[model samples]
Target: MKRITVAVLLLMSFTTRYGGQQTPSRPTVLEHVTVINAGSAPMSDMTILITGSRIVAVDRADATTIPTGAQIIDGRGKFVIPGLMDMHHHLLNGSFPPRPGGIQANLGRLLAVGVTTVFDPSIGRQDFARLKAAAAPDSSAYARFFGTGPMFTVKGDTFADADSPMPETPAQAEAAVNDLKALGVDAIKIQRDDLSWAIKGSGTLMPLEVLAAVVKQAHTQGLKVYAHAPLLKLAKEALSVGVDGLMHGIVDEPVDAEFLGLMKKNGAVYVPTLALFEDVADVAAFARRQAVNWDRAKLQPPAIYAPFADAAGARQIESFLNNSAFTKERLKVARANVKRVFDAGVPVVLGTDTGFFGVFLGVATQIELELLVEAGLTPAEALRAATINAARMIGKERDLGTIEAGKFADLVILDADPLADIRNVVRIYKVIKGGVQYEPVDPATPR
Candidate 1:
């Protein structure tokens, strides 16, 4: 068999030696991998025994002897953790500017990074349902599609990337929510004041009534609502209006004590997409200091990123990054906000806002975990946010997110103990979901 590097694999048309015409199913047993079962009841180690998509048992002492006729993996010093999930992702084909092979390249890169499950808080109506479902279910590689179709933006004033199919009237808004519910979307992404887009350009915000209506109608069908209200006031408003969660910390001012209190009282989960601020600041500084800009030249194709490199998008990026208020110093305040909410024990789910900056999904998920620890989480706590904690937020804690008897067999093989060092969580060797195998590419270390 020809030795393929198995890294930076974006083109899907290529045939692989291991992956071929047939779809791979889940392996029966995984040996040698140190399993860090992220659980609350009783955390222990054992060999995971699987049948179909569910784990049959986890015998602590003897994993090899527990199951026969099972495909056993040679863990060979790898670590095993629950497959990582991302809460805030942009899963759209045309969300960015017109760039050839842009979305395709981004998706491929995401899989390489090890994100097994992703929740695109915002996606276009035309693309979300069709492409999300149209994508094949592989046992491994990339975050599986779990998304809300499009932002419920007001007519005309929507971002160029968004699919603004929102209705203006209360009746129209209610029906729009019903249509999304009928399509069985995971959630609705409520944008800020996009109704005034034509008049105000970018400062446009969604009306309070529209958001309230969407929230009410979507929840009636057992769906959740996520809103993008950057400042404390918007966040508080969303909470007061009974929004399920807040997306990022783009608030115009510092979050006050009263609002923090309300966030705790409401049992609302916060999915702070913090990595963007960090990446932007870090990359900007690097651009100034670096002798050569590699990611722009080699890592990304000019044809792909050209459209997104517009005056408007560039202005937005610069404004967000240039705001000293949202700097590393500000991270202290954000941490205080996180600590305040966390101390109150409000659910702060893990999300990377991947698909930004041409990053692949899988790798971006791990990066999010790394940042979570940097803020305040211990290794185990960080793992929890990505796995068990995320499941709870999605209202799927009863079934998904862990490796146990009767739980789904979605697991990642790591090279070290994430519990001991959360940063080591990226040492992934494979991703197994629902009894299917996504064997990690481990080409022999070059001499």
Candidate 2:
């Protein structure tokens, strides 16, 4: 992960603090909606009552009473589910020195697509305060932002950006964890892979001792450690070191019994960014057939794709295309591994490495659900991965996930039932964040 410049932070702070939308003052009620609570079976003819920023009640519509003067939204034919959470969303643009309006644009696009919360795994430590301010519940314009500070990596690793801390020794690694903890980071992200799949030659991996120290210190600080381990060997090493989650599934090969045992023993969560790998492989395949001309206007949402229409985007695409065979194989292995791991009782949460080339913020999340279904997960199980499972990954299930009373009233009202067909998740009718109903916008249209 790279550091967001001070300039970007200033811009974000200004926009988030002073230029945000207001939430509704009146209590809102959704009556007769089919509710997919994510944790339990879908409930039909449910009534969800929202006051201020919390859900006050959720009961059978026939058994509930409508408060006087409440804003009654007739959800008679709609399906309501917990707002989507993109666990691996990058708040910063994929490119360096992120494009102007990139942060605000990504946030809006995510909210417009029913993503009420986003977790950035590789944010700069200096940007957390501003991110928190931007994600305040009062400002219902964007998805709530949470992130791990800079990702820990070793020195001289090509994948480590200029801003990532290269803690070479155990002490340095411990210090890095302490620094992030002081900054109030949500979690710790460490890189363990050698990047052999993307780069040739002997790629450097983080020292085992240093990786161990980072994980131990992070756990001691009451933070979970998520490792950027894509290969099986690195995944095993990360799990052995007591990391709480694998940011990506094992991509090099099918998962074995030993790996499953380690995952079960550690009670670690598997965040299979299936959409990330599929996007790369799909882009490469497209490039093979024609010239890689990413026309922004041709995209469904031009603003979202505009940032990637430049030379930076081209380079990212070309680099992956150069290793198309490996990339394709990675996607196949990752998909298979997700099913195997999920079947083995290892928790699987939804995460999309959005902001990468071709992985649009909110759009990729929908794609991830579809991909999860393709990987053998039932539509209902796939929804749980993005809803309850994602909240569990961040230890916020008590407050954020499910449709129970007393939780934040973050919901997505869909025109169709996602449990019947996962693609129906994109049939977003309205998005309610913190009891505020935000009209979903067309990304192609200017703000």
Candidate 3:
């Protein structure tokens, strides 16, 4: 596939900003529509001049603001926001080799809903390479995908597992770290020792020592470590070693001020992949919805996901959740949990942990954001978690998460102001990825 050179595709008419520094000047002549300046001290009516892909100039939306020799776009009643981002999302289906068109669907849905950037914290190294290739500017089919493969895990450990295809030894772990570095794995993921062995006694699993060594060695190789910690002893150990980030919310045991202070000192980022739990809930709900008079449906198969669905699955699972929820009142617990964590100042980033669970990438992300708000974030704060703050988490602060010039041209145009109502973010009008414009879908069109 042909790649678009930044020299060629990047702004010349109007300065552009996508994961870059210094907002470029808007075009003296305009094309698309009004420009929206986000992250400003006071966001008001600001018009951006667009000459092709570059934004040349920015000025108030007054009659005199229109430049001569510029093609005017109707900006009367629309809003333009910097493209949205998802810090922790699985690549499409999240399995090795992934699935055909799965990444494409995820990206499309993301762009459709104004998500222009995603950081896939967990991915197969092999799969990561494929996704990275597909995300190249020229032939890419989705929003930008930044990924990290298997965590440093030992053979058959139980908390988390490695998925580099072949088993890894201490020596092999060092080589694995080297291989991932050579292949440009974005960051190293670590979880309370790789525990796949306990799950099935798979001999291929790496031991906790090996996993820790992997993290230690990967750090030497200049890779950041992200862990699926649950405040377990191993998690504390991982933290004590100074991981760069912690994956998953502080489940199992609630994090205290002491833990938060430690994390703060370590400069570790926390990605609460809360939607994973909701995914299980959603699946049960989906199943229950499917069983409603499945035999009477008119489709050729009668009902789409019925035969394979366990009719009693929902009730069975609900019984367990009911007990759990009733015990702690899950929502109340989660809310209190978030308040505790946030009040302690643990750096938070948005993540949905899609692909493995029933949660689809793009769809589940929005749900995560909604839940984040429910967990005590103002919509703007939640937006920052998905955008600017997330970028900071991956150490990509100067690159893509926010809107500024010289940044990657990843962006989303929304019809509504998300800061006002996060849910309105779904009302996306257009998406721009690396300077390529993706026109919005007309809902009236048949799927």
Candidate 4:
């Protein structure tokens, strides 16, 4: 594996100019690479020309002309794919009292694992501002961040934050959407499901009329609404009311034809965070059979596992294990729903609900891809879920997603073809964000 050592040069070009005149810097080119463009056939032996932050050209290596002073990365035997997107991520600030240094560490880990973009479905106004600042394009590292600032839900909902709007009427819901629009949120997130399965108490469901108002106002404001509806009934209600996407799989029951029809009618996307449900079951299974071993833990990476390696972690695992039956059933139903959704031609975007209990940040995205494959999507289809489909969900398909000319040069180079095996996505050779190449993080180090 060849490592590209041009970070210093790339950083310098961002600010440096020759003779007091801003001259175009030499383009960086990836030559003779197998491009696995999401939603399209793979193109072999292609040359990708990148200038500044955009891919300027993608052509056959033999037919393309390299610039006079281009920085060429020999991409022989390597596979390049568009950077992965996590549509339903939650930043560290969402944690109770928030974790110190969590934002920087999480961002680094996410980018290290080829996740160049992430959409946080729930964040407070101040936290969203902070995240936006940290993820600015000028920063050398960090995933491109978009978020819904403060979800809309009823009071006493399990997922509700202090700032979350507990709208009682249609006007209040509209006001909440206006407030989020003022906060510059990329979308609206509505929590409508009772989370009693995870939490002890029976959670409150948001009123359908208020939910409808929120969706309508968000759409009127040119923003999409992504509803957190884990049950079949809630999902149907959200779809009927015009929510643009479901933030989780329908876990209560298998989705029927009517639900699929509503999804198609509303042009909605399904984000089955399968890795989340699987993580719960995995933790339960691990607790039932063996003691905690950080290295051997299936879900938690070392850095995430470190904090919960003691007695507390054991208790947490025990609690989940006690509810193993529910978690396992949810995982089963979620997987089935994903396959049905994909087979029905509805767009299925990849998300892992990262930042939740037991879900590691960077590695969780890869797990989601694998789970997508396990749910009956081909490796290529899974790639599309994480790439082009995610972009479409976020309304950034034009600038992000697919490897093509005039798109952001956010890409991942793999030593092995992910099309052959989805796990090969972890065999990252290099990650390029905004045309700047970054070396993958060493797993031996703490995240």
Candidate 3 residue-wise lDDT, 50-119, digit = tens: 4334343444554334544443445545566666677777755422223445564455445555666787
Misplaced by over 4 Å in model 2 are 1-24, 92-101, 284-316, 442-447
The list of candidate 1 runs beyond 4 A from truth reads 1-27, 39-45, 63-66, 92-109, 135-142, 155-162, 193-202, 250-254, 280-282, 285-329, 358-361, 441-447
RMSD of model 4 against the true structure: 5.7
Q: Which stretches of candidate 4 lie over 4 Å from their true place?
A: 1-25, 93-101, 138-140, 284-303, 306-312, 317-324, 442-447
Clashing pairs in 2: none
Q: Backbone clashes per model, in order?
A: 25, 0, 33, 0
Angstrom error at residue 5, model 3: 24
TM-score for each candidate, following the candidate numbering: 0.78, 0.87, 0.75, 0.87
RMSD to the hidden true structure, all candidates: 7.6, 8.0, 7.9, 5.7
Candidate 3 to truth, TM = 0.75
Q: Global lDDT of each model?
A: 0.58, 0.74, 0.56, 0.76
Best by lDDT: 4
Better of 1 and 3 by TM-score: 1
Better of 3 and 4 by lDDT: 4
Worst 10 residues of 2 by lDDT: 5-14
TM-score of 2: 0.87
Model 3: weakest 10-residue lDDT segment is: 1-10
Ranking of candidates on lDDT, top first? 4, 2, 1, 3
